[model samples]
Structures are given as structure tokens and as C-alpha cells.
Target: MQLNISRGPKATGKTVRLRQTAMKAGIKEKNILIGTSYPDRELEAKVLQLALRGLKVICIDECREEQLAFLRRVKDLICNSVTVHVVVAN
Candidate 1:
């Protein structure tokens, strides 16, 4: 499953909560990925680790202007899938 998470400052906590729920559901810690619109390679890597461990990745774009493009890419990735969730950042 692909989840597009966007909710300003809440996105971070939302991501964490999703992971927690997934963990409680017995989902392995290797299928979740988290992403962000802001650039932070290190943080991104850490988030990736967390996601790969069992949460969705946190995507953070190095280029702010490329965020939309990233979203488009993500959309493309999920097009062939059966389910998708888009969390818009307010």
C-alpha cells in the first residue's frame, strides 16, 4: 500500500502513529515508507530505516520545487496497485 502523507507539522506525528498502528497489527517493520517535502538526506535515511523496519518511508525532497513531481512519481508507483491513501498537508 502507498500512502501520501501531508499535514504540515502533523505529518510527522501522523507518520509515527501509522507505524505504531501497523506494528500493533503485526505488520513487519520492513514494509512501511515515510516521505517528506523538505530536504534532509540524513533525516530521510533515518526515516527510511524506520520504515524499512516496519513503517512506510518518509520522503523528503531535496528540492522544494520538486515536491509535486515527487507526488506525481508516487502516484505513478501506486497506479498499478489496488489501494492508495493520500494525506494532504494542511
Candidate 2:
């Protein structure tokens, strides 16, 4: 199954809760990925690496209007791939 979650600050907890719930329901840690894009390049690399390792990728972007469209494109790419959950957080 695949899921794309978009959210603002309030939804931060929601994402974590969802991941935790999914894990408790039997999802492996390696199969669940969480991340944010506002950090530094090193962090981005780490997130990407983790996602590439076969986990879901949840990218958090805090209300960056210009990035919305770009993120949509990225979502499409992720949906077609075998890896990544591809979440976009505002």
C-alpha cells in the first residue's frame, strides 16, 4: 500500500503517530521513512539515503508555495518506483 500525507505544523504529531501506529501494526522500521527538507544538505543526503534503502519517504516542507508543484512531480516519480512512500508536509 502507498500513502501521500500533506500537512502543516499541527500535523507533525499526526505523521509521527501514523508511523508509530503502522509500526505497531507490523510495519518494519526499515520500511518506514520520515524526513524534512528545510534542513542542511547533509541532512537531505541522510534522508535520501534512508529512503533509498527501501523505506517510505516523508519530506516535510513548511508552506513553501513554490515547492508544492515540484513536490507533486516528485510524488509521481515515487509512486512509480519500488521504494519510498513520498509524503509532502507543509
TM-scores of all candidate predictions against the true structure: 0.33, 0.36
Estimate, for each residue in 1-90, the C-alpha lDDT of model 1 and write its tens digit. Answer: 354444545446655655565566555446443334344354334443444455443333222333444445444433333222233444
Give stretches of model 2 more than 4 Å off: 1-3, 6-16, 19-22, 25-48, 57-68, 79-90
Residue pair clashes in candidate 2: none
TM-score of 2: 0.36
lDDT of 2 by residue, 1-90 (tens): 133455556655655655665565466555444443444444344544544666553434232444444444444444344232334455
- Indicate the TM-score of model 1: 0.33
lDDT of candidate 2?
0.46
Per the 3 Å backbone cut-off, how many clashing residue pairs does candidate 2 have? Answer: 0
